[model samples]
Target: MTTSKKRKREIDDTQRVSFALSDQPVTQLGPVLAHFPSIKPTKSTSFKCYKTQTQKPMIDNEDMPFAEIPMLVAGETEAVDFYSSEETRRGSLGSRYFVGVHNKRTGITTLRAAPLHILTHEVKALKGLQPAAVSTLQRLEARAALGETFGTKKAKLAIRAQERNKVDISAMEGVADHLQESILKNTSTLPSKEEAKASADSTRLIPQYDIDALNSSDIYPLHNMIPKPEWKALSISAYMSAGGGAERVALLPFKRSNWINDHLAIAFASPSPNKTAIKMLIYISTMIAFHKATFKDINKEVIQQKLPMVPSVVIDGLLSRFTETARGSIEARRTPEKGTMLLTHMFALCLHVDDFATDTSVLAADLSMEPAKVNMLFKTLGCKVNKLTQSDLKRLGLPDSAGEVKRAILKTPLEFPKPRTRRRA
Candidate 1:
């Protein structure tokens, strides 16, 4: 303790392996590296790690002598990979010349394009022309500068004729139309143009015939009217019988003779021909012809006239049936004062007689009918028979006292009556 004693060096035994005393610890400890007896290490033999690849079939450099490699220029060398990394940029060009003509009257603007040379020349010539013309030229310049490709110079102007107010062969009506015409005319006159046109004319894919000339005469000569082929085909049909058939069956012969005998032979040849109907038709025809000859025309009074043999009621019934069947007349708007009359006949009468006047009462008196009937007839016929309002009269350039305005024209035909239901008892 008295002598200067140095503390034993503190060993860091944390790195050393720890041991635990166990029943079999002795057996496990015998296998440790320290338990093995040390032996002298042997020296490594001097052998190649990898055999050197036998001097790669020695190339004769003397014979090869670096086959003259082309020397790329300084700039060329840089350019090779220089562009490789960068994206190539390009621009698309559009129409070159722009010649727009504005029609002040029609308000239509025509736009056209010309070659660059033609457009430049046009602009130079357009110096002192109309402001519109000058502006159009300027537009062409601007378009060309913007890298637009002008189509062919369609509008050709004479530059030298700018000084003379006289005939500049360029001036024409409808500038755009003239431009197109000029282009067509110039192109058509080129070499081989006539030959090409002749070839085209000879090889027309669709044959064309003059429609008027073709329709002038019947191509086939069956009937004077119908083509021979059509008449022949129809006559040979199974439906056409010698005794009786549809009118289409007799069409071929009917055209030749439409006399009473022809009608009797063809139309009345049906098996169940009604004798009574035939008599009635004969009577009506005789009455109609007699009235036409005597009174010049048949009216309601003429129709009501009784024949010597037939009863008045029979005549009335026949007339009613005839009016309905022949004229397609409707009996509507019947009043006690004015009995039912054929509306179609009344409409024709009114159209012929009435002056688009508001005086419906006067019209009724003249037509020998009630005012209400007159109003209904005019209304059904789509005529504006009512009095015009004050505003309307003024707009029509008529005095307020213009009680009688013109009769309104019929705009549309009368509509048929709707189906009526029977009253339940």
Candidate 2:
């Protein structure tokens, strides 16, 4: 035989062997298939099928791994429906297939999943309707967006009609004439010249301290001679209403029966007498009596001493709970209406020294306030301003020739001015 014919015969024999191996079972031809690129050996030897049965037969109860299967059913087969024909026949659709429904009562448009036939019916109905003008469409859209209904528009129109039909009494000429007549009647009822003069005379007879009507200087001088540390400590204590201790007695001399002796003892203590302390004590006492003190009244002393003032935050806190600004002036005094126990106790010294009828001049001298201003404060407290005449001076053991001097006499059953009532027209 020729060499070419021999090579062709060898190639045909190899092809026949491969074709024979491909026809055998995978398990039997495992090693032979592994050598071929087209056939791969799987890692697992478990049985598998690409085409699976849709319906599964229920397994026997004895074949189940768990003996006590609570909800097991044996010998029953389940058939699966792939096309969902039941849902289609029932006219139920998913959320993606929805239609907008407008509620006339609520004036709200809501989307709901609807069947295909209902959607087709709505489309046909809309097609049969006449096209709206641009202006009319815009107006309807605006009303829908604003949730304005026909009933609401009707209510608004009814209100406008009512307003138009109503008469305005203030605009009528007869009403104006009636108002003019009333004004003339009111003017006629006013007091006559003689009655006015008598009223003025009666008013003069009553002693009234007209502080607002006075043309006095607002400036009140202050002299601070107290040591910085001592004054600061004392101010903080007074502001806080602190009473140190029971044993550290006689802090306020005014409270004791022997107040004069106590005052002298405190004024002339061991190391050195604090003359400035006495002045401050008296000033604080006056402030407590009136329940008011001004920053302008103490600003000069504070500036002169070069002491650090209390923080505005602390002052604001104090104002909220304990104090309020005095009326009539922005630079007015702050009246510590609440938490005045310590201050009142301190002020007892002044009352004791003044024999309950405080002398305005003496208080003014200590507080560096005008005598008239001090007098006004006393008058506000319902104290009677009496002139110490020759007879009065003699009775009080003073020289008769000292001349008449004014003094505020504090009396029991005090009479205060009645608050004026406002008349309504």
Candidate 3:
């Protein structure tokens, strides 16, 4: 007599888990469930699970909520990047609305960010559109520290959450910019309605400043160029000076810095940096006027000529903190206001010099220097010029062909020594 055996109900099919596509282990086990049969899981709308996942205080399966997963439809990339899991399962949603994801087994929630039907990483939009929590070790450490009790130092960081979800009107322009950038970034065949609308609205929000208005002396005409208060604050920090003192003189008027420390370190104070940046900008405009370089109206030739002048100010400002150029122009890429000013100068220069080109042989004539001297100057400034072809010349804005050239060419050929007199000819 043999007893019939019953296998307890086994979870034979794959259950969703809160894992990113790149690291999800679901695919590796696909072969086990192959050929058995696949019954698609309904989105389970109007169900307890969906409501529980989206609950404010979090429910039992909070860990695997629709909001916590990353996309992982292994072969389907379209489904991965642009579509949401909810949209694919139940179909498209209305404007400014989306249904996220949740894992039944683990009870965690995550955002459904798949493009079409492919799987990708899921993220939770922290309430109020604050920074998507960066799960960095440094951040984790700081967060943990916040929970700890403090002693005499009494460290406290009060974070005030918004009362309501208000569209930041002032940041509408920035949001519009972000939306436009998002559209440009998306290279898919068909964009979602939300994406299209965002792109359109962003285009409308970012006001275009007229080039003529920017050139004009009148401010009212160029009112369109107004940026946010933050931008205004940044403009003040166009340059920065160092703080703290170096012996004898606590804060000297920037002596050339040595290896010990820099000449002027940027102060992070808003509106303006410490004395260094203020003095630096004043110094630059003053010096340029002192040298008296030809300017055919700054507003007209705003982009090219003046822009190039910016790197000088950036270089000088950095030097004010230190004696020597450190890390080359790496530091210049940062320092926001100085960077913007430099860009303006570049724009101005482009405006002034139409069809302006440079050639080593030609540069010698303008500077009244030998070819060797010109080469030396260019090389010291980290420029590379080609011996043949015209790549380097093009960078100098020089023409490719001699006949079709627009700008004047100035060259200093190597001088030839006279041959010994043939019996005093």
Candidate 4:
């Protein structure tokens, strides 16, 4: 036979392996075939058949080992790529959902897996529609790409309203200045009765009374109406016939008396007097006395040293409690050092008591009386007597000395004193 025809016969008669071979494995099979020339594998081929006959391919699946493969039921089996099916590929990375995304600007495609709760282009992630979410990723990206701020509708409206309602502070100041100038220009003109009444009502002092202690008699009286009894309400003839004019008549039944006496009776049932208030009054009076006596500025520390018995805290608290009135009074009493007046004994004599004797002899006798003489007289009689000087009497708000206590008396009503008369020879 010819050589060509003999080679053709050898190729056609070589033994074939009934197995599928892919492009990758076919190269690996070259050495095996070199060792065993009888193995001639064929390239893998997919058969196209009717859907009814499609079950044969799935029934004969060789890709999965028995341990990895699931149990097959007697029905048209799904052609599942056991390693790379949608379910297997999705579950391979655990439960996270993955989405295919492409960025238009960068022209890059990527598979992004997001958490279960976050919304993405993934159909599995879009479980609910969130209407109240103020911003979306697309809106944010659009703003960023444009390189400008784009506020939400609500924020835009609020900004517009604020701008519209913003007040001009300069204009308000100008208006206030104009109004003040107008008021000053019209100062000579009298206000109308209504305006005056309104001003008075608006500016009326509001008393700061403690509401919890509103029932105190000092704050609110029991009744505002004046009471007149039948006895006092009667005619003069009837009063005279009933012996009302001769002796005291009871205004009301059951030991009727003046309200002052009644109030005093009620006070008798109360606790002891406020010694703190008395001490504060005495300390303040003593400070004033020292200022008059020394003819010096009223220094609190010096006054405190002089009156060591007085409590500093009590006086400070009292001054604070009556700050408005007490401050002005204290400031007035504290005269400047430059024009300070030195009070003389004659001035002190006039200041000692509210009553003044016009007679010089009587005044001289009263002022010159010695307390030791009175005490000696009382000592011989074995009588205890607290002999007090005019200054001590003045401290208790009592009538003291022969003349008048000038500080105790209100100076407004009293006329300037006439020059002291010369004694007749």
Residue 269 lDDT in candidate 2: 55
lDDT of each: 0.35, 0.39, 0.33, 0.32
Clashes of each: 9, 1, 75, 6
TM-score for all models, in order of appearance = 0.18, 0.26, 0.15, 0.17
- Ten consecutive residues with minimal summed lDDT in candidate 4? 27-36
Q: For residues 57-158, could you state the per-residue lDDT of candidate 4 as single tens digits?
A: 564424432222322111111231111123332333444343445545444455433222211122224336645422333454464444435776676676
**Model 2 worst lDDT run, 10 consecutive residues:** 216-225
The Cα error of candidate 1 at residue 7, in Å, is 61
* Maximum-lDDT candidate: 2
Clashing pairs in 4: 350-404, 351-405, 351-406, 352-405, 353-404, 353-405
lDDT of 1 at 419: 31
Candidate 3 lDDT (Cα, 0 to 1): 0.33
List model 1 lDDT by residue over 325-355, tens digit each: 2346444222322222333223333332222
lDDT-better candidate, 2 vs 4: 2
> Which residue ranges in model 2 land beyond 4 Å of their true spot?
1-172, 177-349, 387-405, 417-425
RMSD of 3: 28.9
